[model samples]
Target: MFVETEEFAKRLEAMDGLEREAAYEAVVRWFAENSGRITHHMHLAPAHTATTVRLGGGEPIVTDGPFVEGKEVVSGYAEVEVADLDEALKMARSWPACPIVEIRPVA
Candidate 1:
């Protein structure tokens, strides 16, 4: 949902229609292949308009935006269950998004 660089915009524009479709198809294929292992999935809206809500011992405190200001914010979530941490790491690594994917176990 987000990219940090102005250069990325130029690169994105260079992608032709078929290339864009192929990239999307590839991602869809990955999801289909791993569907059995995926426990939960969610797609979130763009983060810019996100509202941050909190409570400080009284009434609910609502803010106009994200918890932190940055080009990088958690835009969505996926929950997967693998054999172990190593397996989880392998799955995360296989994602096309690569380094952008963060795997945190629920406590």
Candidate 2:
């Protein structure tokens, strides 16, 4: 799922220690609860650490940043084997952190 990186940072910055801890626990709980469906998951590093390689051109051009320049960056991803899109949507709707979740089929 793609997360709004800026919004996530702002939320954490606004939270106190206790609130941050609770938020973290909530995320853990969510994963635990959905572990059955989640076949694989990963939390990516910050956007600044990303490396983009453009192969569309004849020569590959490597860039030292995110794939695009936008307020939202894909902070993490979860690979779930659901029955259908509806089920995937249900899971995305319950995400507690980050304001955006983009559910796409695994090609």
The model with the greatest TM-score is: 2
Q: Which candidate should be chosen as best, given lDDT against the real structure? A: 2
**TM agreement with the true structure for every prediction:** 0.76, 0.89
Tens digits of per-residue lDDT, candidate 1, 1-107, equal 21223344345578899977886687678788889998877766655688988888699888887777765566567788788989877776676532366777788
RMSD of each: 3.4, 1.4
- How much is 81 displaced in model 2, in angstroms? 1.2
Local accuracy by lDDT, each model? 0.69, 0.89
Least accurate 10 contiguous residues by lDDT in model 1: 1-10
Runs with alpha carbons beyond 4 Å of true place in candidate 2? none
